[model samples]
Target: MKKLCLGLPKGSLQEATIDMMKKAGYTVIVNSRSYYPTIDDDEISVRLIRPQDMSRYIEKGIIDAGLTGADWVKEAESDVRVVVSLIYAKQQLTKVKWVLAVPETSAIHTVNDLQGKKIATELVNVTRRYLAERGIVADIEFSHGATEAKAPDLVDAIVELTETGNSLRANKLRIVETIMESSTLLIANHNAWEDEWKRTKIENLAMLFEGAIIAREKVGLKMNVPNGALDQVLKKLPALRKPTISSLSEGAGYAIETVLDETIARKITPELKRAGAEGIIEYPLNKVIL
Candidate 1:
């Protein structure tokens, strides 16, 4: 009965991570004010750690593996094995950006304009390196939080994470430069990854997580098509590879099932109906591993 230490990202990514685990066929229960969460899998021990520190912990082997932002891993300069890159965030399935921003009325309009200026951000190290790479020597200050609110009046500029530019716009800040674009990553400790048993377990988890994310954008569709209209129905359908066709035991037609993009489900349904697809069924999917 070997066990694997796993760290789930806390704060903003907490809910999404939990939901993903559920979709991946695991149940996780978090108690109020507790860092350790209860996961149904006895082989896994769960700890809730902030994404910012997740890489550091994994690098030090404090946890075997974790889910964290790619930005943090680069900022920390941690040495770890990346299991997978998950393209999802708090709201959308897209990479987020950390941008250099200044007040709309500020005199600085570009990264070069920030010479000898001060920039506030939680990602102080990465910001410093970014400025240095561009031969810009701006002072990088560590912001505790509310980094978006510290422009012009508080600091010369701010480097803040943004999924959409709306928040920066609302704060009267304009993006001057994109410092980094990051997505979530599943990373593992080098030592843990070397162990045969742990490596297999971590790899299995990665596959499940990946499958769950893919399942989000797809759905399972099942329908019946008449013998005469099978060609029409097949033409109207799209699939992961090809639709599954099976002869109906008591009919002059076939039962067809396939997986397709959720976004196109509605549009294709009516077309499928017109193509003589009957008893049409559309269902959600938990995992669609390829």
Candidate 2:
């Protein structure tokens, strides 16, 4: 098998990224002081590296693919091709604000308030262009980590990525403005995509990752309904595709199943129940393929 190199980000995001890989069916067992992780897939080479430098690494064709935040790739201004967005353990929640935050009690009330102020952020390039476009000039502080702590320490405000905003709230800071929204991105070297074997390996990994991520946000919903209510149930139930329909051996009933987004669970479940669906069940899924 042709070997394809993958760069896994190390740090807080490492644990979740590795978990995602395992769930996607590649065994990756990490150990402290080990940059290379043993994997079930002997065909691929896995290398753990700092995400801060991954964008350029991938762009320079040093690695075939890597996991890093969209914010970092933009900040690095590298020419890496983003293969996919992996939301990790938290899918729906990860696609959220990269915000400008300040202490709740601070005088900064809006984006306009950042003018002529100091702002600490890890996404200096992204933050700089954003601020520059608005004709606002601020003393931008480069933070390697914990940018949220900047405000309470009298750093004026900060531009940082937030998934739930809980960290910002705990730090006594409030979101002042949304600088940009970001999500975890699968990026690969442009030249790597030119090699059929290397490109195919990375693409397969991305496809598997997407399937796993989609399955997490959704479930296979199944239920039984009397044959007399088939039409009604079909009319009432919300489905992304045509629901799988099969008649029971008795012929007076049918089993129906469909994959649906969990976001509508509250409304869909009740509506389905009212439509004569019995023995309703929802099962979490991984790596759903079409």
Candidate 3:
């Protein structure tokens, strides 16, 4: 069996990364505190490490590929080929953010207010670059973990990833400015592509992962509608293609199904129901392919 070295990010990216792998038909089983995990696929060798170190290992040709944030790739300046953007972690594929935040009750209310203030974060380079662009300077302090708690105590503000900002609010912090927005990127070494067999396998992995992301954004909507409303429903329904229309069991109407964005779901569902559709079902997708 061929081996494909894989770097899975530790910390915040670990859970989501592993989950994505499982959803993509690979199971990573860890029995100890070790960095290495047992993967179900014979083609993959999985190692868990901090995302900050991922690009270096890839750049050095130690790992064949990795599931790390795009921010880390840029911060570490690793020369690895990015094959796909995992749609987890930050929903947006690009232009992600790490924000500078301060306590809501504190005097610091905006980005300008953060000037000359002490800000703590793990992303020093990202913070520095963002602050440089805005022409505002701050005393950036690096924190390994618990950076949120240190804010307003050991520091006045913090630069961190904002996903729903629930944690920031729970820690009594409000975003003052966005530092850097990042998305998880799949990267492989330049040399990895040199091996004909390995490169083909890597590309296959990328295809499967990308399909999983597409699947998450969509759902398989199946319903039965009056044959009379078929044309009208087709006009109103937003699907990847013409809704799959099949004859109903009793020959009452047509059974239709399609792939659609989850965002427009709620609105379209009621319309389907109003259009004399029944057995309307929306299911979470695991994989989608064109």
Candidate 4:
């Protein structure tokens, strides 16, 4: 079978994507100045491309599959199948929003206020469509970069992407409205999706990536509890489905294991201990299939 050509996004999302792939049981190595990354998998070849260009290239069949933001796919109007929506951004594992913003002191308080105003943004097409949807006609300029700084003086308002909105607030800007929410997506070319061999491989990769993402927010917990208190201890603990329980040798105790949200471990641990659970173990997880 021919090797699968995959394009990895090369900007801010690059490191995080690579790390996730590593956790998903793939070895990815990219040099500081190199666009071609080497992967340990023999069935796949990797190339680094900007997120903004990934959708169009995949649609054109330049590559079999790639990872890029949902917004880019929409902006490019590419005809590709989204294998999965990976909800993450540069430094955050949450949805990011593209918003219309202006100076805090500006009189523009709503999307309608920008009827004839000037807006700067890197997403020219998305911005144009957004304004047209609202029946507002405004001059949209393509910002090379630093779109947030172009407002007030360079433009009347700006459409910028923000994960936490901290950057906008720091620049003394307030969001007038959210234009769209985007998440990372695994996309496949139409031809690739139709090929049986390629479809299986792409689906396998998507499953692994999704498993790795699930593992990031969860942890495995194991502990032993007296038979008398087993029921009580189990009642206080939470699991993805149900906790795994097993008999200890010679009926010494019950060994219990389960997967749970990492955030609740601190509180749950103490509660379990008080309920006669012992030898508690908490560990990080690389992947969870379920």
Q: Write the per-residue lDDT of candidate 4 for residues 1-290, one digit (tens) a residue.
A: 58999999999899999999998999999998899999999999999999999999999999999999999999899999999998768888898899999999999999999999999998899999988998999999999999888879899999999999999999999998999999999999999999999999999999999999999989999999998998899889988999999999998989999999999887789999999999999999998887
Give the C-alpha miss distance for residue 31 in model 1, angstroms: 0.7
CA deviation > 4 Å runs, candidate 3? 90-96, 105-115, 133-137, 224-227, 246-253, 262-270, 278-282
Worst lDDT run of 10 residues, candidate 2, spans: 87-96
Instruction: Quantify how close model 3 is to the true structure by its C-alpha RMSD in Å.
Output: 3.1
* Rank by TM-score (best first): 4, 1, 2, 3
Score residue 274 of candidate 2 by CA lDDT. Answer: 87
1-290: candidate 1 lDDT, tens digit per residue: 89999999999989988998899999999997899999999999999999999999999999999999999999999999999998888888789999999999999988899999999999999999999998999888999999988777789999999998999999999999999999999999999999999999999999999999999999999998889999998888888999999999887799999999998888899999998999999999998799
Worst 10 residues of 1 by lDDT: 146-155
Q: Pull out the clashing pairs in model 3.
A: 96-181, 96-182, 97-180, 97-181, 98-180
- What lDDT is reached at residue 84 by model 4? 98
TM-score of 1: 0.98
- Candidate 2: residue 219 Cα off by (Å): 1.3
TM values, all candidates? 0.98, 0.89, 0.85, 0.99
Q: Candidate 1's C-alpha lDDT?
A: 0.93
The per-model lDDT (C-alpha) reads 0.93, 0.83, 0.81, 0.93
Ranking by lDDT: 4, 1, 2, 3
Better of 1 and 3 by lDDT: 1
